[model samples]
Target: MQQLRISIPKPCTQNWADLSPAEKGRYCSSCQKEVIDFRGWTADELQDWFANSNGRVCGRLSQKQLDYFKPKEVRHEGWSFSAKVLLASSLALLTSSKVYSNTFAKSDSAIHQNTNEKGSKIKEEAKPSDSLIIIKGIITAKEDKLPLPDVSIFLKNSSVSGSTGDNGRFTLQVKATPGQKLLLEFKCLGYATKELEITPESVAQELELEMAFSDEGLTMGAVVVSYRRYPLHKRIWNFIKSPFVKHR
Candidate 1:
């Protein structure tokens, strides 16, 4: 008997859509050699296979499947790369504006506080000293104990003077140094003038004064007197004869 030899048929290269389901699962020498399948497979399966098989997948895919899995070129809205940059810049500007506004507000508050402090300091420096003593008192009639209005109250031998108010109260400011003696005089119509000595220790206290009525009235009658002198020649003859003639 002669030796027999049979040749196996090679698998046909067909698209995934043209392969029958039974043929799609069958092993092919070409696919086994290539280490990949050319049959029906989902996009997910292809992606998974590609990942696991070092970027290998089915060589043939259906047109519909390819179209479904194809990456579409997305059309961006009006916002582009430059628009994004502009938007980010705008946000940054707004944030800086808020920060600057807060800074300005704090600075303004500090400036106002400093101004007030300076004003207070200036006022303190400009304030008058306590050496200027205030003398306040009431003037009244000694006989009637009634308030005397328009009574002149003044420092003795000084031009500074104050008049009593309707309430008979008078206030006078006098510069009295430490350990200095002060003399205040009170004068009024129909009243005897009064003087009071003020010491530094007693200057702060209010004074109460009573004035007595004057005994000498203001009205006085005028007196008239006339005198006649001898002539110069008659006075000289008299003077010359009086020495020679003795009085009888």
Candidate 2:
């Protein structure tokens, strides 16, 4: 009979959790030189290491260690019916709110624009028509044809009055209807008073008035002396008694 010899593999003495990091490193160097210690590795790190090592057993790992370091499959479930309904409702509410806000803003802008247009229209309708006529003229001396200042121009039946400026120009604005007759009176201290009658057609053109010097100084003095006496009867008697008293 022939003698036979056989070699048997040794049972693993240290598990992944049983050995400290330094002891595992020494053991890996002595036994499996290519094995890496994956005791403190995260799931992602283990998975990456396993993938890089082509799923080769790196070292002796217990079942607990394997389970702890195994990468869990991420089972993503599609949106549930209730979740989809909630999302759709929220989106619809947000869209409706935005639409409502935009519509309200546009309506407010249109309302303001319409109100402004109506206000402008009302103002236009309420505006008054122009009825005033402007009368402008110049005063001058009749003899020398030179401009005269401080001449008074007044309307006969109206309170409108104006005086000539230094340039002998006068302006009067009065309200008058079409085809109405306007009476203007011009007077000065040493000049004879003059009157002018104008229609609207004539007022559209500028006017120039010449005034002649008057000799009413003596006549005015005689009139003043006649009124010196107060009573009406006495004034009349004195005027009769001394008609020539002023000449003397």
- Per-model TM-score on C-alpha atoms: 0.35, 0.36
Residue 176, candidate 2: C-alpha displacement in angstroms: 0.5
Model 2, residue 206: displacement in angstroms?
1.1
Across 146-209, the per-residue lDDT of candidate 2 in tens digits comes to 7878788889987899999878899988877777899999877546789999976687777988
List the candidate 2 regions with Cα displacement exceeding 4 Å.
1-130, 218-248
Per-residue CA lDDT of candidate 1, range 1-248, in tens? 11111111232344322233333232334344221322234555644444344322233333343344443343444447557878999999999999988799789999999999999999887635437778888887665466777788889877779999878899988776677788888877546788898876796778999987553432111111122343444445566877674321
User: Which one wins on lDDT?
Assistant: 2
lDDT scores in order: 0.57, 0.59
Clash number for each model: 1, 0
Scored by Cα lDDT, where does model 2 land? 0.59
Q: What local lDDT score does residue 207 receive in model 2, on the 0 to 100 scale?
A: 95
Pairs with steric clashes in candidate 1: 142-211
Candidate 1 local lDDT, residue 159: 76
